[model samples]
Target: MKPTLRAALTSPFVVFTVFMLGKIYLSWFVIFESAFSWLPLLTGLPTVWAAFAPIELFARKRKLMLYMIVNVVFTSVYFAAIMYYKYFGVIVTYHALQQVGQVTEVKGSVFSLLHPYFLFIYTDIVLFGLLLTFRRTFRSWAVRGMTLNRAAAGLIFPLALMVSIFCMWTNRDSINEIKQAQHMGILNYELYAIFAKRSEPLLDESEITAEAIMKAKGLAANPSPNYWRAAEGKNIVVLQLEAFQNFLLGLSVDGQEITPNMNSLMKQNFYFPHIFQMVSQGNTSDAEYMLNTSFYVPPYGAAAQDYGDRALPSLPKEFRGIGYEALTFHTNDVVFWNREELYKALGFTRYYDKSFYGDADTVAFGASDEVLYDKTVTEMARLQGEGKRFYANIISMSGHHPFNLPDRKKKIELPDRFDDTLVGDYLTAQQYADYAIGQFIDKLKETGLWDQTVLFIYGDHMGLPIYSLSSKEHALMKDMLGRDYSYPDMLNIPLIIAGGGVTSPQVFPQIGGHVDFMPTIANLAGISLADHLHFGQDLLNTQHNLLPERYYLPSGSLINDTTIYVPGRGYADGVTYALPTGDGAMPSEDEYKRALELLHMSDSYVNQLPKHD
Candidate 1:
């Protein structure tokens, strides 16, 4: 019955702004987990106005419809950002539109990320839809407008536009994308990204040589590189385990081993305990690209989507040049994540996907890891019988995310506390993956393929992202790891290189990334990368590395020998976290500069590569 309050609340301007502001608050809480602050509102208002102010400026009628459309659009953006951040720990941009198909394929993973509160973002739309059924109520609520005068519209339009542009321009150089979005507002940041030019010019093709890459990485030529040509002439086998992490190595659940086979392999081979996953939007495909090409993924999108057309210089290509048959095997369809084109670009002699694996024993995307290894081993045996020198890239799938393995595949027994949780599911799935790897290794041995093969096994990316963990799951992880699981632990993945004369049973503590795989393998296989322009150094030879990370972590993030430096705005305000070694030594500005330079060099070189026919 309060007429003045009801009238003010019914004003169209106040109604729309309130809805937007509430959505902004939810988005901020989900993304930043910060207490109430005026920054988002201050930065977000102008951008929000730019979207809706036009309706007031131009259209007199159908204003409600336009506002509704804009509201829906903004709400979707905020909701998407929230969902994406929960798993990825990064603000999603429009570049994510390219991943719409990929997202649909992983609906289980997407749905698992959804919270009931997240769905509340659409409550207003639902109410509005219900009101639409009653024309009188809809008109009374939506059309009861406090219309802005032409003079006010003229003033607000330019001022809001200028403010949005200013926000974008001022915050453009903030290398940390999350901080940039925070400072400039998420909506404005998305707009800025769409139109933003590359901050630095591309280097000339001649300037992007291997030597230049080495220099930028602070690594010089190694005259007598360690483990050089140790596996010269051996069959190359690369097994990319899906969503596996380093913490799983030797990890136990109440006296039972989690990855026994991998632990055994690590004990008898060259194991890298400090390699971090550097995948971007492409996830597994990004890891594949980085491992084979020694290149960073694209800045904003998946490598397979953005650079799959290029005939990339890769480990497979290098091996094929030396009279080896290079092939890749994945359980999923080749079209998923555009890996068909990606495999071709990497210069594989042949690739076997879902068609080869068949739909039988399917888990997440395709055939289970057991089936993948079983069939792949049979094929490898055939190749061996034919006396073919081969380079095989086998991608395991059973351990993919949403980690809910079928009961038949669940080999690990979870305690009551670990029941029905992501961490528990992840462990069981990875345990199954380990069992599959064990089977594959045995088959390799039985067929005499193990002794002759230069086997490289590594986790594709992280599985239990810290952002995806519930509080109980977080506590569980802390219990498992003996400490709070941090970014370094999240990004860390195991890299095991067995056979191929790498029987040293040594664990390399030197920091490395997926990008280091190619050079490291090339060295062991007697293949020279002197002519190859790669961003990563060989982990076997290099004692120090500055591994620049993307996607899951923020921009301007890098892993050095002693710490992971994550920038707040830029390096000045960045925080340093200890690696597993317990040294949180701050990275230098030079290292940070070189890390960025290395990324740029990779981008420039890859961008100039000849497109595949």
Candidate 2:
């Protein structure tokens, strides 16, 4: 080897720079599928040097140790971004730190997302550790020492820092997080997110009214609404199935039904096939919050963590106001997602959690779905005996992620190819969940509570993420869905309203989201939302809707009646994916502005609400 080239390669600064650049490029490739662009290089250089500058300037000794530490930290950030993108299909920021406590609970699902190649990000760190173990060998090849001159260091440090800051400032307005990360570089973007403040002005509560929200959403009021107060004075039962998606409604594999009970329920009641999920970082808890309050989550964190401390207007409060008792049932601990505070904020009269269900037949977090429904029914019957009109929420957790149902609980058989695959496991789990639901229904009928109550069933969020699927699983989903599984399919979940009010069977094809659940249920329960502040319209009476997405998708993504539009940098460079109906609709700037304004209004209104003592 040439002496000059060998010396440069042996230098710690050059060696560390090479490793960081390689990892950065790898992250770009994994996320965007194209890393050849010069943007990452241009933005990455200054950002990386900015971190190196201070140590290079002031540190006179132990330079190698500091560099290695910094390198490991940067590598960790890049690795986290890659893993998070694979799991959530969005860039990771410091805001995710709030969810670190939840990682251990869902470790199975977290590990399932790991690919063998992703571990390469840590190869250099391992080798460095080993080399450090044998100091003589490491020093033999390592450079003796090196440092930038005082004057040179002073100039380079500030210049590099300024360049990085400039990159972040220019692209700060980009609504699509991925595009912003690409332009400013992942390192610069992460740093900017930690230090930056929102520049937009918050709208006053007075300016945020139902008329303004309706106008922004482009939805008109229905004078003679169908099914209004149809289930008046009846009991309300809501079933929130975890990780359940619409594709499982009538799916069959090898002539075996995936969710036969739900299919039958759909045939005998009101089924909404076009409802999409609107959960944020809190996942299931976010679904509950949106369903009860009919409001969007915070811009940066989960609603439970950010807004649960306030006294929010919700469906439960609406019921409680009319002398009806309100309660919720979940097998998990109430503290898992700050749900204790959330339940209080939602105004539930009572909540039965792990303490009420016990640890028997445990599934993901606590008791299995069978136990949840079994115990919940007993309590429901008790409430009925008390002559109480009640609102009861039951959340099912057996079909959660990493869908590994216990063999004793498994209710379906899979083909050889389907065995041991993520998709197969998911189907088997859903089948078991369906069986549990069947048992719950039979119990309700025997107790005669079925005819006296209004049962509402819906999915909490998506189970399978498109980016996390393998090629084989992708092919399997294509065969099941009749095409490649897209964003629309991932976001779509079923909403079935049965018993009391829904006497006739029918399917509603209008587009809606969890945000619309509050008003829809209020209307059917013969409750008035006139004095209450809610952002959702009654889905049974609406044909036009605009659903703005967050957390899972980009910032500017919106769903209309015909298609889901995802913005790149803005409306012009954005793309539209067809819904189940396959409509070729175009996106407009006016619609994009309206979607954003609605979100801002929601945030403003919720923020201005008075906190509970």
TM-score of each: 0.97, 0.97
Question: Judged by lDDT against the true structure, how good is candidate 1?
Answer: 0.87
Segments in model 2 whose C-alpha atoms lie over 4 Å from true places: 136-159
lDDT tens digits by residue: candidate 2, 271-360 = 999999888889999999999999998888789999999989889988998999999999999998899999999999999999999999
Which clashing pairs does model 2 show?
none
Candidate 1 local lDDT, 1-613, one digit each (tens): 5876677677666688888999999999878889999998889888888776777778777788888899999999899889999888888888899998897789999998888989999998988877887666575554565665667777888888999999999999898999998999989988888898445788888887777777777778889998888999899899999999999998998998999999999898888899999999999999999989888988888999999999888888898899999999998999999999998899999999999999998899999888999999899889989989999999998988899899999888989899979999999999999999999999999999988998999999999888888899999999988999988888899988888687578878888998889888888888887777778788899888888887777878888888988988888899999987658888889889888888888888888889998
- Cα-lDDT of candidate 2: 0.88
**lDDT scores of the candidates, listed in order:** 0.87, 0.88
**Predicted structure 2, TM vs. truth:** 0.97
Q: What is residue 87's positional error in candidate 2, in angstroms?
A: 1.5
